[model samples]
Target: MKASLLKEEFKTNKYDEMLKDLYEDASLVDYQKDRYANALDKFIELYGDENVSIYSAAGRSEISGNHTDHQHGCVLAGSINLDAIGVVARQDDVINVVSDSFNIAPIHLNDLDKKDEEEGTSEGLIRGVVSKLKELGYNIGGFKAFITSDVLVGAGLSSSAAFETIIGTIIDGLYNDMSIDMVTIAKVGQYAENVYFGKPCGLMDQCACAVGGLISIDFKDTEHPVVNHVDVDFSKYDHSLCIVDTKGSHADLTDAYGAIPAEMKDVAHYFGKEFLREVDEKEFFDHLADVRDAVKNDREILRAIHFFKENARVPQIVEALNNDDFDLFKKLIKESGNSSYKFLQNVYADFDYKHQAVSAGLALSEIVLGDHGVSRVHGGGFAGTIQAFVENDFVPEYKKEIEKLFGEGSCHVLKVRKLGGCKVVEE
Candidate 1:
């Protein structure tokens, strides 16, 4: 377990053989391969090693539950083929990190275990995690790393969460020797994004991306979320899961995104509370006027209300899926959509594009699939992708119509792979 021994193993592992064996046609998607290649090239250039090992975690599509995660509420989500992958070669005392999509230099691994926000840009997520690992009293050896992500940034697919999860797993498996629990590692990734990277996101994305599979997260106490993995067969079902891009502009929506959690905290303060999740829906609404006046921002109260309703819907949605009740699921999906639009109000800024994407899918699902299923806004919902549970029989026809609106490849069929944070084929 010496650092030098691990470094030697990293350089000698049959990575090509491993990748070829690991990347079954079903194992990795095309974009992931490209990102993995890019990361490998960076590893070769920076660390002078053609033989760096790889660890990967895939991005997720929000199957159910939207803006609710911010309040530490429930979310039903699953992982997709779009993954964030990394290649690591052991380096003595200094771990150099490089990312493919962003033009950032290899970060020093030694300094990383103690990163400062001013010194680190987006890369601070990685440095901060490493730094915290050491503080947690873990044995973390240094390595040169190259990371690449094919998950579309700002697409609501949570690309950053995917990356941070994989990086945390890499540290736990390769450096810390998997001493930290998987959930704890996932939390570290979330902390890296929230505190170090300055992205005001919640734990659902990181947890969903890291945990993989179809699961409902009860963020009633975000620090201790309750998770229940659902067992459902997506392939046997006769329908397609589609994403229709709303094409709603997110420009100038930065503060609107940040304001959600901040205002929720303000709402909590109105009642001398912590998070809006702590309050009941009727209790929250019975005092809507007072809650509205207390927060002073109509939008914040709206966002907080959505959290209550959405968290309540999580169990109902999961039950619909478990019982194969398409009608129930579809109805719930539409209700969730309306809540995001009317209550959460993310759709108000640019209603037209959101309409084009969401309304079109809703209409199409009704027309084409008959009584098959429903569609809803996938994630934060400013304007990106809409998640629809489609009828398997009419999937192609559904994709054809939706693609005409959002371009080809807009709709993707994904399966739940709940392997959790894994490090396979280690050198």
Candidate 2:
């Protein structure tokens, strides 16, 4: 499920295309064949080049479901053309990470097995991946990686997951026999983000970003995620999806986001379970009174309800998509967005006032198109963009409403990309 409708054009293996872009872009300015070539050159200048190879991956978009992966629910997602490319030159038993995306110091694996609970950012993320790989008995050695990316931050896309997966893939390509699977890659990436990055995040971002394409990831069991690829072809219908950029400011989402999954877990724990999915309708209703009594916040209760309901909606949407019932699917998205606003507590986060983006986008959209326009919160739903199914005739009207709020380039009209995920080219 690429964000771009031009699936035929996007190279199946994003790394290969990114590599070419890196070479061509850097070469236009006299750049090396690989962006990290300079870093490898520096490493050799310091020590010596032994056995080194390069590998990479790209970011992904949540095509259908939102926040469902954490609850062991369903999510329709896939990789995007934009990615981070890393060229690693393996060396001694040292694991060094050189990143162009993050302008920080090069990371060296001295005590690679240790976790730094203090400064939780790039280094911890890198070390986190390395630590997980080492724990998994993966052969990890010294390598210099240069990274570059097109994935934008704060856009509701999983950029961190993309970087981590690329790092893991680079490591796998360098040492392992190229027998790495997407699930393993996803876990290793999640390990880095959760333990290393210090973000109490869920598996959705890592899975979506790692697996790529339109996949239904079932996390009913946290230890194993069952990923089912779904075919999403909406071209037969004349409708299009335009994510409205409600030109609203966003908050620092770190701590605020940390609260979401934590709180959900709390609600589930009230029913004696790991996630809302584990608690059956009977168990939830049976313990509803206890849950309400135990939790003081009303929004918490509402969010709990939203999680359960949204979880159930994933499969329905998948069925609707298969039947080409865009109308039904469109209606479901609106329902999900409304629930997120009313229950999930993400509709309007207090941090930096991010909720206004979704709210304003919906307001403006409704003003222009009476009933044909369906707009709701997209992605994490606190801000950024809202998914809107607009009438083709109302394109100009939709653009006007969107531009007035988010400026000229705020709203994006996108079609579904079909080519799932794969390595584009070796050369």
Candidate 3:
């Protein structure tokens, strides 16, 4: 169907069934329809009413194992319903993308080499994904797309990863056989971020956004991570997952995020290894004094300890979830938050004590939920959002209270989506 025809169908309620199938939330059907309609309108405005396909890639939440993925550690992550959506139509040789945010990016697929001038832009991600796909012996080509996202910027949700995955999905659906696994798409996204975007991020964000649902991922082998889907029925427990955006800026925090892996690797270098995961916990503890002396950073030593303990906690949390032990899971979550605050020391930048939103949010959540729920510093953690597992019935009250501190609509109730990066509309 053409873009114009799709718009007509949307107005006539011809696509409501499809939307229901895609979202699985009857309550969101109208909202999803409106979002798609708006994207289609924008596409028609920019690229004309050519026949286009729609694609979606979900944003991710780091459920557990904070800042451990870069060191080949274990983590539990989930894909939230928030996502990036694209309306795309195949083109001859050039890929043109106009997003709701930022200027238009046009990339020539034939000349898909890293451009120094394109670093830190969406064009870099597009070219990187294309280059990676071609290198992996997969099909690649050009397409014109209108992209938009609900993933909040700088809120710890993996928005960049979601956008990268959206690109990968568009390419897979349009040119390739659409047979590339989500994990491969995620790796391509990570490649884009690391080499093209100039960020030394781990595979966790991409994997979580790409794999979808609640998953237990062990990155012991970076090339082939072991991914297991954990069956968690949130409705059964009467709990809701909420993310509170504290409106903290991530500006000038690159060094803070980068230092985590750097210092952990420094400790590993002290023990003749590459990552903290390779060093045994007992050996690290036994040589703690020597390691501290060699590294000469007490914070680094504490971070290493956090990594080991946090890694150990992943499986226990998974086990508790598998056994339907919400209490134990909540307990481990609190412990993880405490470890992140005390040992990892990423709650706030040392210099910015005046703006401690994460600390204040955690403290408030503890007071509000008491022994009924769990809250923690979410994602990269220096500044952004906090994750809270709240009782379903108490959600409204919790959202109301939190919003009072962070302003209106700061609290978002999220669901774990089952699908990752994929083409939502085939026609």
Query: Which one wins on TM-score?
Result: 3
Single out the weakest 10-residue window by summed lDDT for candidate 1: 1-10
lDDT of 2 by residue, 1-427 (tens): 1112112223244344454443222222223233344544543444454343445565666755567677777776666545665545556665555465345555566676545653467777778887788788888776665566655666666778888887777667667755678778889888887776777677877877667656777887779878877676555666656766565556566666667777887888887788777778677767787888898766667777887888788788788888888889878877877777777867667655624667776777777767776776767867677767787777777887678867897766554443322333221
- Predicted candidate 3 versus true structure: per-residue lDDT over 8-107, tens digit per residue: 7787888898777555457777898889999999999998989998999989889899989989999999888888999999989999999895766678
TM-score of 1: 0.83
By TM-score, the candidates rank as: 3, 1, 2
Give the alpha-carbon lDDT of every model.
0.69, 0.66, 0.90
TM-score of candidate 2 versus the correct structure, residues matched by position = 0.78
Write out the backbone clash pairs for model 1. Answer: 72-219, 113-131, 238-392, 239-391, 239-392
RMSD of 3: 1.5
Q: Model 1 misses residue 88 by how many Å? A: 2.1
After the best TM-score superposition of candidate 2, give how far the Cα of residue 361 lies from its true spot, in angstroms. Answer: 1.5
Candidate RMSDs in Å, in order, are: 4.8, 6.8, 1.5
Candidate 3 Cα deviation (angstroms), residue 173 = 0.7
lDDT assessment of candidate 2: 0.66
